[model samples]
Every structure is written in structure tokens, then in C-alpha cells.
Target chain A: TQLLEQSPQFLSIQEGENLTVYCNSSSVFSSLQWYRQEPGEGPVLLVTVVTGGEVKKLKRLTFQFGDARKDSSLHITAAQPGDTGLYLCAGVATGNQFYFGTGTSLTVIP
Target chain B: DARVTQTPRHKVTEMGQEVTMRCQPILGHNTVFWYRQTMMQGLELLAYFRNRAPLDDSGMPKDRFSAEMPDATLATLKIQPSEPRDSAVYFCASGLVRGVGTDTQYFGPGTRLTVL
Candidate 1:
């Protein structure tokens, strides 16, 4: 089974603070996706990183794919209370198999 | 925006009863997946279907749980003789697969099930 470990399982920060969540794996992936889930709702896709050593920015969020495609990261700049949610990273391997991360719960206090 | 819809947003039932959850995927999608989420296990894929044909169901408990996509737009998951341990949120996701590349899966709101 492929494992996607996420760091800082729980995070609480004041509004406007910057934070970064990391997703790491020993096995290489074809693509990695980041999602944000609010209470009582399913996860919503945030972004997908396909190429190695690639970086994509969406507003205040930046996502990076590792050179080996075995890791990824999500950095949030000037986070607001609306950013509070459970962040999950899912890696897709060969045969379109998906492995989800342990998840990071972020709470941005206003 | 296209969205997946699920029925019985919440369900509370007694142990040993049968429970069924339904999902309606967005139009034009060709793949559907069933997943279960619990506090301990997070999210796990229970089954997957492509073009209404089941592709994988390795993550499901063969004896008590069953999943099926009868058509392109509808999917269902059933649990018979449910147990308290079966209580959790069940989600259905749909996407269009292009070759072997990664596909973006859109998930439903999920059905929160509780077995007493």
C-alpha cells in the first residue's frame, strides 16, 4: 500500500499567518492532488500537480511537486479564516490508483 | 457547475438492519467511485466502476458491503446486517478518465450513517 504522510496533523494559526503543509511518500506518483474539506462536506479539489519540479500558484496558495514525484507541498500565504479546513493530498499511481494522505486540519482564527 | 448528488444526507438505523446509499453523478462523467470515511480510517475506496462496469472492489468487505453502478449516472452502495462499526460517512465520486493519466474526481456531499 502506498502511504502519503502529511506533517502537522493539526494546525491553529492567527489570520494573516503563513503556513505550509507537506505531503511525502516513498513511492513515485504519476500525479498529486490537493483538496480542502469543510465540516459536513466532501473534499473539494484545490489543485493538481503532474510534472516533477513543478509549481502552481492559485491566488494565495502555492503547490509544488517534488523532483522525484514522491512528495508535494502546499503553502498558504496570508491565510484567512476561510482557509480553515481539513487539507488532504492524494497521489495517483500507475493504473490510476489513488492513495490519500493522513490529512492536515487547519484552523485559521480571526 | 456540475455536481454529484447523494440521497438521504443522514441516516440512523439499528444494528442488523439493511442500509442503502445512493448517488447521482454529473452528466457526461464516465467513471464512478464509492468511498467510506471514518475517524479512524480517514477515506478509503470501497469500489470503482467505469462506464457502468465494476473495475475494482478490493477495499470493500465482500460479505456485508456491495456497490454497483447500474447506469452511467447512478451508483449505489448497500450494507446488509449493518453493525455499529459500519457507522461512518459514505461518499461517491465521479470523473472522466483520459487514457491512464490522472483524472479529477468530483465528490458528493456524502451520507452520514449511524448504526445503533
Candidate 2:
């Protein structure tokens, strides 16, 4: 079973569009991380949210942790072609287990 | 840049052959994790180590898969008699564990394995 499920598994948008991806889970987590991966490379960490209701902004991207620590969200404003990649959300559950969410693959058309 | 490094970026072998993947975690990091990625399963955690000791490996198939940390810097995952279904991209990540857990993980360029 997937602990974390992301909505809209695949997304395609034109440049300058805005988008939001959601990561939901039934279990609570101590911390959550967001990563962006390009082709032929590993996922690169974007941001980490530790506290409930925490929000972090990285460049044109924004990451938010749920109030209950069971979900997270990633938002991009004025998307660019460089934002096209696989976005993954990972949570640190109890016992230090790292659970990755069903990734959201985004494609931006120039 | 001190990042995780993995060797044999691509490997192709026949079924029933043994496959070994190696990883070198970033220096001074005490935690190591192994993951496999595929279209069907996404990214699945296989095993993890802390301070050169295995902390958890329940996600790994014990029959044909084994993971070991020979030293603090080197971690290896081996598959004996690998099957066709074992073809996937294997990733290794390392992090520094604080009191709670590691939230930031630095991943390496995965090793793509194909078993025909």
C-alpha cells in the first residue's frame, strides 16, 4: 500500500501557468521533504517541512506541510520549462522509515 | 561537492546471474538507504544502514537480496540469481540523522540494471 498518494499523477501545462500538487496520507509523519528530478539524474531535494502548518518557498516553488502532518502540498507560480520533471514528496514516519509518495510528473510546454 | 556516489551506472545481465551494486555515501554522513524505482512500484525502499550497521531491511526480499555495509563509507546491495523482474533503477541516499530522523536525503545517480 502506498502511504502517501499524490493527486493528478500527471500534469501538463503551458509556460507561465500555475499549478499545485497534493500529497495525502492517512498516517502522521515527523517530517516531509520535496524533491525534483530531471531525466537521467537523481532526485534533488527542494525543501523540507518539519512543523505542522509550515511553509517554505524556494525560487518559484512553495511547499507546505499539513496541519496534521499527514499531508503536504507543492505549488509553482508562473511555471517555466525548467520545472518539467518528476516531483516527489517523502515523509519520515516513525522508526525513521522514509516513505516516498506516488510521484507527480509535470510537463511544461514552451 | 560532497554527494553520494554509485558505481556501475548501468548493468545488463542474463537471468539467474548475480548482480552487485555499490555505493559510497557522503563523508561524515552516518545514514545510508537503498531504494529501487520502476514504473509499476514507483520508488521502494529496500534497506537502510546507520553508522555502518543495518537498521532495517524488511523491505528487501531476504531470499535472493542481501545488503551489507563493509565500512562507514561503502555500502553494497547484492542480488543472487537475479530474475527478470529485478530490472530497475536502484538509488542510494545518505543523510545525517539527528534526534528525530533524517528529513534531508542526498541521492545519487541511480544504477540502471536490466536482467534479460
Candidate 3:
């Protein structure tokens, strides 16, 4: 089974701080996706990176796929209170099955 | 905006009881998935269907857990003789396509089940 492990399972930072979360896997993935989920709601897709060494930026959020397609990272710049939530990284294998990471719970204080 | 819908946002039942959760995928979506999330396990895929046909259910327990897509619009997950370990948030997601390259899944507000 393909497994994705996320580091820094929980993070607490002040507003305007920058933080990075890592997702690593031993298997190559066809695509990787990042999602942010608020309490009481389902996860919402933030970005999808399909190519190795690809970087996609959405406002203050930056996502990077590893050069070997075995890892990914999410960096948030100037995070605000609204950014406090659980962040998840999922990888899609050759068969289209998705494997999710352990997740990182962020608490952005005001 | 199109979204997946799930019934009974919250449910509380005793052990050994039957638990059923339903989902309605977004219109035009051909794929649907069921996931379970808990404080310990995080998120785990239980089953998924494509074109109203079950594609994979290896992650689900064969004995007590059953997943079915009775129609294109509705999917159900049933657990018989549920145990306390079954208490978790069950999420239903839908997607437009089936492949790994471009399929984007849209998730529904999860059904929180508590088996006491």
C-alpha cells in the first residue's frame, strides 16, 4: 500500500507567521493534491500538482511537488486566523486510487 | 455550485446496532467515494464507485462493512453490528472523472457517527 507521511502533525503559530508542511512517500505518484479543512466542514481542494519540480502559488499558499514525484510541500506565507485548520496532502497512484497523508493541524493565533 | 450531499449529519447509536449513511453525488459526476476519519487514523478510504458500479472496496471490512451505489445519484455505506471503533466521521466525495491525472474530488459535509 502507498502511504504518505506528513511531518509536524500540529503547529501553532502567531498571525503573519510563515510555516511549511511536508508530505513524503516512497512511491511515485501521478498527481498530488493539497486540501484545507475547517472544523465541521469537508476538506476543500487548495491545489493540485502533477509534474515533478512543479510549483504552484495561490495567493499566500505555495505548493511544491518533489523532483522525483515522491514528496510534496505546502508553505503558507503570512498566515492569518482564517488559515487555522487541518491541512491534508493526497497522492493519486497510477490506478487513480488516492492515498492521503497523516495531516497537519494548524492553529494560527491572532 | 455543485456539491455532494450526505444525510443525517450526526448519528448516535449503541454497539451491535446497524448504521447506515447515505450520499448523493453532484449532478453529472460519475465517481463517488467513501472515507472515514478519526483522531487516531486521520483519513482512510473505505470504498468508491464509478458510473454507479463499485470499482474498489478493498479498504472496507468485508464482513461488517458494505458499500453500494443503488443508483447513479445515491451511494450508501452500511455497517452491521457496529462497534465503538466505528465511531468516526464518515465522508462522501464525488468526482467528474476516474483517472489519477485530472480527477478532482468534491467532498460533502461529513456524517459524524458515534457508536457508544
Candidate 4:
């Protein structure tokens, strides 16, 4: 099993709809990161959450770290076609071990 | 913008051939990482180096895969006698690991390898 698991593996939503993506793991992390990747490109860093139960906002997107630091969530307000891409979450475990989740591919239809 | 750059955005080679992928990390970045992305495995870490020294390569198939950093500016991943199963999009990323959780890893465009 992967150290990190993200679900709905695939998401398709209409414009203006709100959606959420979840990343879960059995192991606690020192921190978690979110990245967005488009086709023919690399993943770009979106946000990094360090403290447990931390909540960060990036414009229309809201990111939250679970109270146990073993999970995270990403929520988008008023999704748009421009938001179509693959969203991946990464975990930083003890001893600086870093790993990425399988990722959630979201398609925002206009 | 100082970003990671990888050479030969795409590569195609026959089985048993040697394939070399190169990466030029962002200046002053102390950590270099190699990853392979496939439909099934997602993004798997092949190896990583800190301060030009290999820290971990457990995720790589040591039989045919090799990773090296000749200098701070350059990193390389080599696959000798690559098989069709080795085909995937390989990415190179560089970051400054300050032991702080907020450090960011900047990724390259990635090399699409197709072993025939």
C-alpha cells in the first residue's frame, strides 16, 4: 500500500461547483504539501502545512491538515475549467523521508 | 526564474540499450531527487542526493539503474539494458532542505522514456 492515499482518484465537476480532495495515510507526518500538475509539465508546489489542525487559504482554495498530521484536505470554491489538472499531496515523515500520494485528477468542465 | 532543467525531454531506445538522462539543478540547491511516474505506480522516488552525496536509492532497481552526481550543477540517471517496463516519465527535482517543513522542491519538465 502507498504511504499516502488520495481520493476520489478522478473528479469531474461543473464550473462554479465546490469540491474537496482528501489525502490520508496511516503514518504521522512532520508536514504535508500539495502540488498541481498539468499535462506535459511538472508538478508545482501549492502549499505546505506544518502544524496539525492547520488551515491555509490560497485564494479560492482552502487546505487543511488533519489534527493527527496523518491526513490533509483540499477544497476549491467555485471550480473553473482552468482548475483542471492533477492534484497531488506529499508527506514529510521522520528523518526527512518524503513521498508523494497517487494523486487526484480533477477535470473542471465549463 | 531559477528552475530545474532536464535534457532530452523525450527518449526512445530499444531494449538492451543504455539510456542516460541528465539534470541541471537550480543554483545553490543542495538536494537533488530523481523520480519516475507511471500510470500504476504513480510517482516513485528513484533516488536522492544531499550535498552531492547519495543519501538514498532504495526505490531504484539497482540491477540496471544507476544515479550519480558528478558536480553540484549536474545530476544523472542511467539505465543500462533498459527494458520496456522501464518506460515512464522521469522527473528531476531540486530543493534546499533546511530541515524546515516549508522548503519547496522545484521540478523539471521531466523526460519521457520509451524503451522498445
Candidate 4 chain A TM is 0.97
Which residue pairs clash in candidate 1?
none
Off by over 4 Å in 1: none
List the RMSD of every prediction in angstroms: 1.1, 1.0, 1.1, 0.8
Question: Model 3, which residues run further than 4 Å from truth?
Answer: B98-100
Off by over 4 Å in 2: none
True contacts kept of each: 0.55, 0.70, 0.67, 0.76
Across residues B7-28, which tens digit of lDDT does each residue of candidate 4 receive? 8899999999999999999999
Per-candidate DockQ versus the true complex? 0.76, 0.76, 0.83, 0.82
In terms of docking quality, model 2 is: medium
Candidate 2 lDDT over residue span A1-110, tens digit each: 68999988999999999999999999899999999999878899898899999999988999999999999999999999999999999998876789999999999999
- Write candidate 3's Cα lDDT for A1-110 as tens digits: 43999989999999999999999999899999999999999999999999999999999999999999999999999999999999999998865788999999999999
User: Which pairs of residues collide in model 3?
Assistant: none
- CAPRI class assigned to model 1: medium
Listed for every candidate in order, the interface RMSD values in angstroms are 0.8, 1.2, 0.7, 1.0
Point to the candidate with the largest lDDT. Answer: 4
Second chain TM-score, each model: 0.97, 0.97, 0.95, 0.97
lDDT tens readout by residue for model 1, A1-110: 43999998999999999999999999899999999999999999999999999999999999999999999999999999999999999999887777889899999999
Better of 3 and 4 by TM-score: 4
